[model samples]
Target: MSDTTNHQRIIALEAENAALKARIASLEARLQLNSAPPQSLTHTTPTATPELSAEEYLRYGRQLIMPQIGLPGQLRLKNTRVLIIGIGGLGCPAASYLSSAGVGTLGLLDHDLVELSNLHRQILHTLAYIGRPKVLSAIDRLRAANPNVTYIPHITALDKENALEIIQNYDLVLDCTDHPRVRYLVSDAAVIAGKTVVSASALKTEGQLVVVNKPTSSEEGGRGPCYRCYWPRPPPTESVVSCGEGGVLGPVVGVMGVLQALEAVKIISSGALEGQRAPASANEAAAGSPGTEGPSKPEPASMLFFSSYSPTPFKTLRMKGRRADCISCGTPSDPALKITASTIPDYDNFCGPGPDAVLLDPKDRRTVMEVGEMIGRENVVVVDTRDETQFGITSVGGSRNVPFVLWQRGGKVPEEFWRAVEEEGNSADPQEEGEKGKGTKGKEVVILCRRGNDSQEAAKMVMEDPRARDWKVTDVVGGIGEWARKVGGVVEY
Candidate 1:
């Protein structure tokens, strides 16, 4: 009886072991199936249109080798859509590589038409393409590089009306706009869409790129902070010269744009890995291996600046929300400082008491904000030569617009534009005349522009006048835009 019972027990144990082996085999097979690119994503399905063909498979064959971008990774790239909001400087290069890398769908947007000047850094617009839309130029260049991708060109400038809808369809956004106002808009839109934003900027000699997304917005396993999380409000605009005006080295923008592309690819690849149902291959896990992982890192979600000059690596700021005493973004949330892009106070409001004025560009050479302050006297006459529209756009402070364009073409007119300049000179007291007061004729004329272009022209026009020939005409080479930034010039929409 004991022998029979033992025999039965042995048989039962053997059956149990066999059952466990079968289960393990089934799981392994399922894992392989899970790792494959979805049929719908890889091949065009009637329900889910695949964008690639046999030709594309051969084209991207090399990229498919690395585990991260293997067959599965390539499919993620094919399904992803990226919106590049600026096609100049940084945007040019960013769009180029993303297209070269075969991003499935690409959106090109820019309001400006290409100029011969853009050719220095913007490789997309050839001499033949000059005077053409930047968006169209970028699209043509991108398509010429890779016909496998789909291109959408937008000639309209990016504004609130289309910011959300246009940005929403994209899995990622590239903010390559030149203006500070536009940058702020891009950051804000990224927050609203909860999409990955690979923002980059380049000036004279610097470039910067960052991965901005929140920690709970889907896509990647964990949502990361958006650009706004870093700079809740646009930081005080800086007094800087444009590359077009200041003169940038040809390759600087290219470097920055390439970096932007690198970040975008990383964002897409990261999202694919997180969304996958199965474990990635050993090598696949190491791509885009950033040192830090989550929100615990300081400067949670914010804007980052990069310089082209050596020794200046990366500067990122995570703007805090609704600070009690903060200005701009912080104060508005406070309800006390409701400053916005559209509604700033007048230039002559009670900003600082005691009848004081800030001089922006005292010298005519290049950037002269510091010179203006050094020689500028108290309660003195200030002459800003920028046009009226630019004056309003930059939120010009303590200055009147005697438009250089008008003065350049006015042919001696007596309009409100000229009256303001003459009155500013006549109102100042004579005793403090040497540095502060201007001889209605010899007074230091402060000329400015968005970049100092019109201002320089204005100064030249003033010098051309026989009556003001000997008069001192100072060109704030960096202009009011720089002035507003250096002297804390606030911007209204």
Candidate 2:
């Protein structure tokens, strides 16, 4: 029972030991594969640095070879995700450069439709996409520019309901939106998600850029100040004019967008964008906050301002650090003011009174076509509510110009303008009135403007006039734009 049985047991033990060694080797190999950088989901096999393909290397080699953005920085850019909030003036250039620079993932968010009017500034879209949703058009253009990046298009408006969820997926956010409510929304969402925000705004000949919500140093205690820290709330609606209303120089917006792209690139690459040369001026100041008091010296963050009209267009000023009581990012000093996504204000209300605040009843609005049909009827008068300068440029023949700005400021169309309108209505032949029984002796006032928005308020103002209580007042939906598009006429803005 001794030597033979002992030899058999030793052989069995040796076989078990060999099998265990093989199993351990297999497990170790599997672990190494799992720990490597993620391969492309489109790939059928694992690869080293699969994020950067051969074609990509050829495309980005010039930038990859730079000292500041070498291989490591290029890889960081490839892994970064950026969300561009709007595809209009600022977003067009920002998205374009970010994609070309090899950002790994891009989220395009816009709800507007491309129009012929947008072509001059929104370079991401073209005449071919005159009626397409902006995000889709942007995706098509961006994909053509760079297929290496992943494009996520959100073709809806970002509101309180969806802002946080959508923004949390991106490492950084570019607030290219035009609306104040949207600016605040993006800022708050970025803060809550702990993401950096690069914001840019352009109006007429001037533009401003700022980076917000960057991580603060240990001494600062918490994150940097958000948009709200700079602007506690949006300015009044009448005071805040958009590029659409006031008109902007295309190059102004383009320059701002490019700067926004630069900020995003610098943030992702972890490189200083500051130049070695001295600043242009010692007295340069940052763009001032509209309503709040600002620091005497440059703050932790910086705001860059540009103007086409200025001799020295670019100016940078430091922004204040984390506000101890910021409702969005919270003060490092005060815990009670700490805010969450749920605690954020209804952005629409905080921005200003919304459309619902002065919402007109549906019955009070007439389609542009319906108003067009009523144009030749007896006792029906068309009031063009645009300013006098706008009315002089282009208008429907025989329509009276009420000049909405005057009316808004507690003035009315001069008594003579109203008298002439009544005379024109009365001049319609009785026989014609008989043929078109829709005609009436009572005044039927139809209001129209560049777009339908101002017309509603204009109609309401005319209705409440002591003399016009008996008159029938209605606003033309889509205003002159619909009239020009559907009924046929020149719509020169």
Scored by TM-score, the top model is 2
Residues 396-435 of candidate 1 have per-residue lDDT tens digits of: 4466666554654555422544456556655654443343
TM-score of each: 0.55, 0.72
Query: Among all windows of ten consecutive residues in candidate 2, which has the lowest summed lDDT?
Result: 287-296
Error of 1 at 27 (Å): 39
Give candidate 1's error at residue 481 in angstroms.
17
lDDT of each: 0.58, 0.73
Error of 2 at 236 (Å): 3.7
So what's the TM-score on candidate 1? 0.55
lDDT of 1: 0.58
Candidate 2 lDDT by residue in tens digits, 36-155: 543333342224455467787789989878876765567667657689999999999999999999987788888788888898999989887776678777877887889767777776
